[model samples]
Target chain A: MKQSITLGSVTRFIGLAGFLETIKNVFTGKLDKEDFKNIFRKVIMPLASVLLFFAVWYLSANKLHEIEADHLINKALVEQGPAEAEKLRACIASGDKSCQPNALPSPVQVWGAYQTLLADHYVISADKKAFKKKTASLNAKRIANGEKPITYTGRPSFVDQIFTSIITVFAGFLLALFIAVPIGIVIGLSHTLRSSVNWLIQIFKPVSPVVWFLLVFMIVKTFTKNSSSDSAFIICFISVGLCSMWATLVNTAMGVSSVDKDYINVAKVLKLGPMQKVFKVILPSSLPLIFTGLRITLSVAWMVLIAIELLAQSPGLGLFVWEEFQNGANDSNSKIIAAMFVIGLIGFMLDRIMLTIQKMVSFNKND
Target chain B: MSYLELKNIYKTYGEGDNTTEVLYNINLTIEEGEFVAIVGFTGSGKTTLVNLINGLLEPTKGEVLFKGEPIVGTSHERGVIFQNYSLLPWLTVGQNVYMAVKEAFPKKSKSELNTIVSEYVAMVNLSHAINKRPKELSGGMRQRVAVARALAMKPEMIIMDEPLGALDALTRVNLQDEILNIWGKEKRTALLITNDVDEGIYMADRIIPLRPGPNATLGPEFKIDIERPRDKTEMNDNPNFKKTRNAIIEYLMEIGNERKSEVQKEYILPDLAPKSFVW
Candidate 1:
């Protein structure tokens, strides 16, 4: 009974209690009134809210489309007279791509844009595969001659850009973790070091991602000038790292410094070596807080990634959004809206991933 | 020389004008294999005294000696069971004990270390919870893990700082007997710091009161003349137990009252008002 209770609490701590219960209920076919209420609140309510959101978005997009179309017709009437205005109206009524209003995309338009991007990805994948097959012999010959192999340099599809963004964000998050945690431990260990370094953290913490990007650009451009490696990718990840690391650094320092005095005493009484004390006692005690910091760092990194990628001209979702907006085609708005949803969804997923990891590592359930 | 000795120890916090002397002239000595308990009220710097002996904190004046050598730093020879349990939350009961045992016996084989961890954990009646983390355990269970961890190291001396103070009466008594049973077997030099007079009388050969602080000092020592293998229920019927208990409690109350009276000394506040700034 004790073993079961402990196991139950452990599962509950990781936030799998409700989820596991639902799964059990589903398999057992024993859904009661309480379970039904839970399912309604947890699943149905969120879906309803999302439907309401889509409805509002669709209505607003339709309103804007109508307004823009009206404005265009009025301008044509005044500038090109009734014949041209009538011609424009006829063209719009026929639903020609050229005369379509460029406004906020409706839900249907966004869905169409999503399908188009997916089709574009497939086409690009086929083109690349064919290109590789065609160049196989030539590439082998080039490699035999000790020359660089020919490669396909094509515009990345929406899916490719998304993968790029995700990769860059992960690289940035790792960089933040590596740089922040050790420095935080050192700073946390010594009051003098903490106080002296505090000014630097304070000054740098709130600095904008744009500024960090510019700073990284200067350094990376210099270093990678003669190299074949992607400098913009380096700049994007570095900037994202620098922008997001402050929270983790500060939190880690706080966590390390405020470790329970009792734990420290335990460390002392055990006569643990300095390294053992830190690794066994200090790190374990401070882990929950460090994880909290890491969670924040990841979200911040993800949030800043798009901006950095945009600034660095990295072929990512940020660049995709910016390019779509600049293109100003009839479907550009729809495509941008589609990208927006993808970005939001990915960010939410990233946060959940961090949360799950934090829960796994943290002993304090309340945290 | 005694197995553990604290000579003229003075522990103060802060510096210059802001300094507060927490413990003053804390002199104590426990012979080899002797069990001693220091009884003090809350905020009477009992932990400060414990820390001083455990080598976690250095005295402002004087020094602590263990086995006729001046102690410079912590050693596995002296195991401390803290009031808060202090079991690393991330480690399970078995692992917490394993960590301490490993530190104490770095050259021991892995299998040997595991045996020690399991043995000590079982001694605390926590074998069922060997795989459970501290956060998953009840307060009493967590304290038991702490005890197991401390004992697993096989320290020559055990220093307990109110190890059972946070437990309910039933758990407290259970743990007290468990600790005494272990102590009886090994006859290790032990120092227990607590506020409960009955606990002091029940566990130790000598009960010494720590006078209330701002400058806390060791008060008179009351010797427990009761024979070994002391029974808890029969202790109430014993004449010596009653006498010692009353003497310790009376001494504690007297000091407590003195401290309270000293605290109640009124200070005249200067007549002042916030100056209204003219616009």
Candidate 2:
């Protein structure tokens, strides 16, 4: 059989057949009027909106910069008279580095900062590689001698901090899954248990991540006081887990409890053991809702991760952002803006990942 | 000894002033190899009775005996095909049947279980859809999968609770024939609860009516004297089929009339005339 990769097949494979069809129609000069309109709405509209956003941001940044510069010139005139004010104006007009306004960074500056962060990451990676090469024989010798090898104490780059944040979020997410699912199932199985535990969930669900961080900090600090390992990561992850787990707990309980009575009847008729019934029938039936719960739990964990990291003083994006704010360098504002975009983009990607998993597991294709 | 017996079964819901008697003094007995159907109006405690038989529910005042022993809980010996086609949506048609078969014959090997599952699926003429999930199948196909799941268990008895109610007329007739063919082969002790009088007469050895509730009970039994391998087209001409169906329908109608009269009320209408408007 001759296998052909038709345009239709390729478009379908990429999940953009409709859009691709419109593009093809336009190129061939056979576009339907409606298809042309749809192209504008679907493709061009979003791109245009993004460009509009950048234009607005650039204008706002320039305005803010001008206002700050004027404020600084006025302050100099009032505090130190015309000579100093003239000197400040001269410095500002010279486009000198010292007189720059510490205001909102322009889009171009943020882009530059993003590139700078990448370059910094590459430099740090090269340094780490070199250090590894230098210490390879020494590390091997130390391992042979049953002694601890020398470890690099270099500060993490922007990319390393992002990874740290992602890892912490995942660890917290796993912690939440392990703690909440079993408890949710147990509570969901029994009306009495559900009612008894209802108040506890309600009270804790609304508790802030900061408070959770403080509580975890107190407990983890006391427990790991004598240990050599730093307890910030432990505290950070635990706080995130506690902060984010309530959604999963509530959703899982609801899912398990609200499983179709017909399915339960089937289980009864089949005389399935309690464990078998749960795993084979009840869990499978309730999986969609449980996944919805997990999706919510993961997004919540990621959202709260930064706050927990900042409070716990863990080496993640949250710490990086705080340090940038404290440093108040000329490009620090641009770096912060870059981090904000990265955070939002990463959160969106995490949600999409969860949605894909949920779709794969769920029987209800309509969702 | 009776293969199955329900003596003085009374099922009630709530308590004190809130108590509503759903089934009252419902007594029934089925001998070995007997096929009995309890036909009734909708919401006439037909399901409650089936549940009582299947050990999903307890009779308030009486005992359910299976093989001269008091029934405790659900068992593989009596498999129930529920009205709503209670197929686990996540499971494929084959897996649904295999699940029940595995539970029924725990000692059976994997291949043996697979063979039994496929055999039942093929019996339902749904071999093509064996790997399809319940949601993917049509209503008729899902119903067939339910039948396959129940029969694959190879229970000593089969209990159906209005299993063909949701199906269209053609599918209903087709399934009625399929079920009759399967039951005829093994002569398994069966109880089918349905509202369709003709369905009861066609599929069952005996037809019994359940009176409408607040307090429901089994009424008179109509014995179906139709011959084995009954032809659906010829059933219209068969005097026995006509007699049995008419008698069951008549009994059901009489009870329905009685219940209607008990709750009937007369209201006087106001003498009013519509005013004509020229537009």
Q: What fraction of native interface contacts does model 2 preserve?
A: 0.91
Q: Which pairs in model 2 have colliding backbones? A: none
Clash totals, every prediction? 0, 0
Model 1 misplacement above 4 A: A1-45, B259-279
DockQ of 1: 0.67
Note the residue pairs that clash in candidate 1.
Answer: none
Real contacts recovered, all predictions: 0.94, 0.91
- Predicted candidate 2 versus true structure: per-residue lDDT over B1-279, tens digit per residue: 788988998999999999999999988899999999898899999999999999999888999999999998898989899989988878888888999999999999999999999999999999999988888888999999999999999999999999999999999999999998899898899999999888888888888889987789989888888887888899899988877777777777788888888778667789899989979
Best by TM-score: 2
lDDT of 1 by residue, A207-291 (tens): 9999999998888889987998878888899899989999899999999999988788778787778898788888878888898
lDDT values, one for every candidate: 0.89, 0.90
Per-model TM-score (chain A alone)? 0.90, 0.93
lDDT of 2 at B10: 91
Give per-model TM-scores.
0.90, 0.93
